[model samples]
Target: MRFVPRPALAAIAALLLLASGCDLLSAEAEVYDSPLSADDRRAPGPSYLQMPVRQQGGAVLHTPSGTRVVRGAYDWWTRDGDLVTAAAGGLLLYGADGQDGRVKDRGLNPDQTGSTGEAISALHYSDRFRIDVFSPDLADRRTIVVPASAFDTDQASGSGAELQLHGDPYTLDGVTWVEWGVNSEDDTLTDHGLFRIEGDQIDGVLRNEPIVRLYPAYDGSALMLLRQDNGEDEDCGGCVVEQDLVELDPETGEVAAEYGMPPGYDRDWRVDAVDKVGDTVAVRFRVYDGEGRDATAQWQLWTYDGEWAEREELAGVRVWFQDGGRLVERPTDPAGSPSTSAGAYPATLTWVPGETGDLSDGEADGEVDGEVLFEPSGATCRLGRGEEFCPQLSTTGSLLPRE
Candidate 1:
């Protein structure tokens, strides 16, 4: 039997179709590259904090390991309402039963009081950051104080270089999305440190930890944990994350296989947070220029090769280098897409603005001098010149999404 590399075969088929010179996609085009204006930029979030939440007034700290309430007058209320107090197994408790009917026990506050429009919102509850629910009132539905914490400092201040945690994800072009971490490692209000817990066993190099780190790789699963890192030094530089492309056995939290992406790409691309199809992951990118004469759009896609060990192995070569490439699409339903066997692959045919080729009549307004192909190394007519996987001479229709 003749064996051919699946990825190589796919790349070749993609080459033939893409090199045919078709119209490009735009942000608003069918291909859909996310449209980003000059105003869309973000900054890195606060490095870390020791404690982001403070206990509210008249509050008392009590651990449930010491309580044993079995029915009778148990602390009970609906998920969408204020907490109610009830005398139970040797203690006074305040909490609510979720819509699923699970009783959530919160410690009691001797002086808890409130007025109109002042209760905690169940929808706003986040396990990642600390929330101090003080003086909650059921009758008034409002409280004296309800402070929530998110790992962001200046909610209104930021530049385009760093990746701030909250607010307007669309404005930040290259920024990846992350969520707060929550688990048994006890990222308590006062305990700030970096540690790892495998199953029930916690171990790893230690370091002073930050207040909060975004870890969206967790999503919803039993392998949930915000792996808080040293955030500054080499070994601990990683942020609080649950998992990257490296899959973990849901029930066991054991090491599974790591998915493949194009090489040289960092975990910063934010792929695990998007939708997936079994082993395949699809991406949504902002295509900037579209097809046809009236074209004014961009579309993008990043597909993950499930069979490979690391995505970085396929990193496209940097012909001089500029910003970077994108991991844009994830395939859904293996049977729905074409075979990854010989003669079939998923790739795009694009018209890159920065790396345009074949400019003979002394360059356009912004076009550079003596450049057939413009890369970070300047202009060139050489075979492998720019960041583009192909050339930019489209004499046909728009480039459609394909295998």
Candidate 2:
């Protein structure tokens, strides 16, 4: 081998050691001051919590100026500012203001359940049937067992056998009630009746009628929307003849209040949904064309506050209520741009408790004015210079790109 220059070899070896030393120092720095926290470090609190209760159709809870808290997925009931909800596993007690939330899950097997000011009631199915009543905190109070044959099963003219229980149980005063229907096998409600349960006793059929739907009033009354069978129309083959909305007294089983369709609408118009707050009732309906087909584009929303009725025709829009019986409307077309036309997806009206700086007078109505809150989808957004804006955050908590 030819002799190599000592100085050149030494220089090359020095360069290699320098490069390896730099890499070691860089790695040491990274390990010593990493951005990640230790595993046992305390975690930060959440910025906000998602509400647990899902609104049923247009039904919403009017909270009393605070964050609302609830538990489980269940049917909800409200009376005099108190909230009650039940599930197959348990029952929850809370306040309208989201205070004093309590849950009890022991000894509850509710197939159908309801709550009143006094107690919570549930119907459990075993070899037979049993009704269990519990305190608001779910303390066991009483249980009643009844025979399955006690319910009426009158079949429709051409339909097969009748199904036992058609709907969830409801409560009034201290009694629990459930609806029994026939023709359930065909998924049609032909005939129906009500049965009452009080303490350890079961009462016979209290009332029987062709009720299409039933809703519980805030004052322990039953609102029954009935369809009258006048046979099929000869001229219009599949048209409804008449429909009635009647309020029945829970004790006497008599009509307490009755509502008729507005002046122009006939029986062909059908109710789509019903929502109530305090003494006010909101009814949403759809009109039918002359050919007996549904006119989906034509929607009418009506509100009755025990004094007079107000009606509004809405197309491709949704409406809901605020805390103080206020009605909010929003367009539902996705083609329309957000923050300029209809609000963003899942837009809803929310009541802001405090003052919004944009208002000329610094007063709060517990209502949303877009400047401070959004509506219809309930997503919180900001309004500025005649435009609505929603906060968009990036995965790393930075503001997303915008025009």
Candidate 3:
């Protein structure tokens, strides 16, 4: 099983697929669509914040007793109280649901997996050139296998060719597609593409485009893409790259609409996260300097009106994921200082991104403010209901919603 480890916190550096030669997927490719029924995509049960325990390798499920699941695997997510893990063994689901323990386990290789907050997708190699899709409840599965020649690993310049699944599989008009890419062995450059299994047709759609990041619109109405110019930039010395925010039409594989970035921010900035407000799209990015270094440690949040007209940038605020109609925030007032209290580790402050209104006039003050959710006195972190977990500061585990 071939496994590619990702960096901590952010920046999901995908696997490298070979590139010496390029062509559309041959007719020999096979796609078996087992569409997920409405009942198969059932809403998840009550979720709690689960965090990984540093050095321990497993995660602490913030239940009443702080249940621990998925031992020896840090890459995991929760669906209906079950744990889906990408471990050396394979793609596994550990749960106490109807089944006794492990409910579903598939793939002969160490799968490169991601999720759409509802379903899981894995790009499997070795046994076969295929992408495996798992339903939210692990009840239904779909497989799409392509000819080995389609990858043409013999042509790859470095580290051989390997398929990289971007984000997760998404559905449009009853068809499911997964955004994929090919990156250099060093992961410095990437050629974005798309792959989907619809009916009897399996295709590598939008092959080798300059788009870098593909994410579902915050509102789940469209796909948002950050596209770059294919032309080389000989002048800036990699200082800046022109990019655009556009909504993609999944059915036709084209840009349906373009969203405007704030003046002077259309280039040299890397997108960190994106979400939707009432009528605007909230994007978080880190601006780079001439040397391609992040200019600041804190991520900037900006909002673009839905009409592709107005834009506003929020100051001095860093936002995490949006949970239950509220944007979670982590403040960075005294830059470089994680904790003001002596002998205390940095705490995760949970707060809202203010009210969704005219942000330009600074009426969105609550957007920048937050309250401390928890504080770590030592290695152990204590939360309400007598729940506690010790997280290593080195890895600094993420906050995930789970049951």
Candidate 4:
């Protein structure tokens, strides 16, 4: 992405913010300090603290041993063996002694976060949109600024016009990319694009696409999910629009693969998440069975290999990502799982890296042997037992109960 001079960009951003009636910007950026207190030590409880049930927006970082949960603005917690530590806003660092600590806050808060390898990039919005790249140690590396016009928000409605960055930024093959859009409640139309960032310059690979989503592939490529306009449907009473998942090469911006929803289910299914493990790609979809007043839901996992034009759906299982391009799966109970009833799961799951070997090879044939390293639990609960090929985790109530 190419950026104008900072001085000019700042002026443009201020004008745009004023036009939109957003007064949240300060004359100067506010600094944040670490909120950790003396009493903030490891407490006796679940290894990891459960984030507030409602604060569901955040990012998950895969660690060597377990997963790190970054919740809300700055709260973060990570699991180490049988212990979990909570810290306030700052960088997260793992020590050589198997411990974690938070660096003093640098006063930087971002609207969107993305990661690639060990590098994390934060996108902060203000008068001028800025993206700050950081090292794994939280050291600032480079900053890129773009004029507000680049985002192009429409002001049709009286509500403030603003730019929105959708999903996380992705870094791969020495390049970083992010998806951004302009949304106005009054206008039904929205503009979006996937832009490639090179230093201060950004180039749009897919421009002005409607409702686009980006996911990084295991081999430095990206999967672009575009919600297609099928025009108005007078025949169906209530139908959900489907999205097309296209795999594009990051370096060349060429479509490497593409997949669409199956014929009969296109009207009532939506893509939940796209994940890659080794050479296999899994796309999760939520299918609804009826119209608005009586709809029922269930989750489906679809696996695709690069060469195979067709995809296979893994029935009745929920999958999560592991550190080394591996995926873990567990049975989903239709009667009790919230994901099957409400279209979303409350709690997120990340695998404990190095606890199990790669099951990708057998994953294609639907036969694999692996162990479940993490368990879902309340304040006090017993650990579950292992099954023939799949291990189990005990819980007081279902971690993701039906709504």
For TM-score, the strongest prediction is: 3
**lDDT per residue as tens, model 2, 1-403:** 2112256654675577587763211111000111111111110111112232223222233344444544444444433344455544456555544555455565454666665545566665541255666665544567666565666554644565534554556656666767665544453444556776666556655345545556553233234444343322233434466664544545544444444444455665666555443344556655555442223223456555433243433333333322232222332322242223112233333232222112222112223343323333224444557545432210000000000
* lDDT of every predicted structure (CA atoms): 0.23, 0.43, 0.44, 0.44
lDDT of 1 by residue, 126-223 (tens): 32222223223332222111122322222222322221122111101222122222222222322123222222233321223332322211111111
Q: Candidate 2: which pairs clash?
A: 346-377, 347-376, 347-377, 347-378, 348-375, 348-376, 348-377, 348-378, 349-375, 349-376
lDDT of 4 at 91: 53
- Model 4 per-residue lDDT tens digits across residues 1-403: 3111255655886687688775421212111111111111121112222333244444333333455554434322211112112234545554323455554654555566665443566675652256666654454467666665555445423556566655666656556777776655535445567667766666766665543466653222244444454533332434455455555655544444344444344546666666454345556666667666466556666555432222333343454432223333433344234333331232223332332233343433444344443434442122335211111221111111011
Q: What is the lDDT of residue 68 in candidate 2?
A: 51
Give the range of the ten consecutive residues with the poorest summed lDDT in model 4: 394-403
TM-score of each: 0.22, 0.52, 0.60, 0.59
Candidate 3 least-lDDT 10 residues: 24-33
State the lDDT at 10 in candidate 3.
Answer: 14
lDDT of 4 at 344: 27
- Which candidate, 1 or 3, has the higher lDDT? 3
What CA RMSD would candidate 3 show? 12.6
- Clashing residue pairs in all predictions, respectively, total 47, 10, 5, 4
Any idea what lDDT model 4 has? 0.44
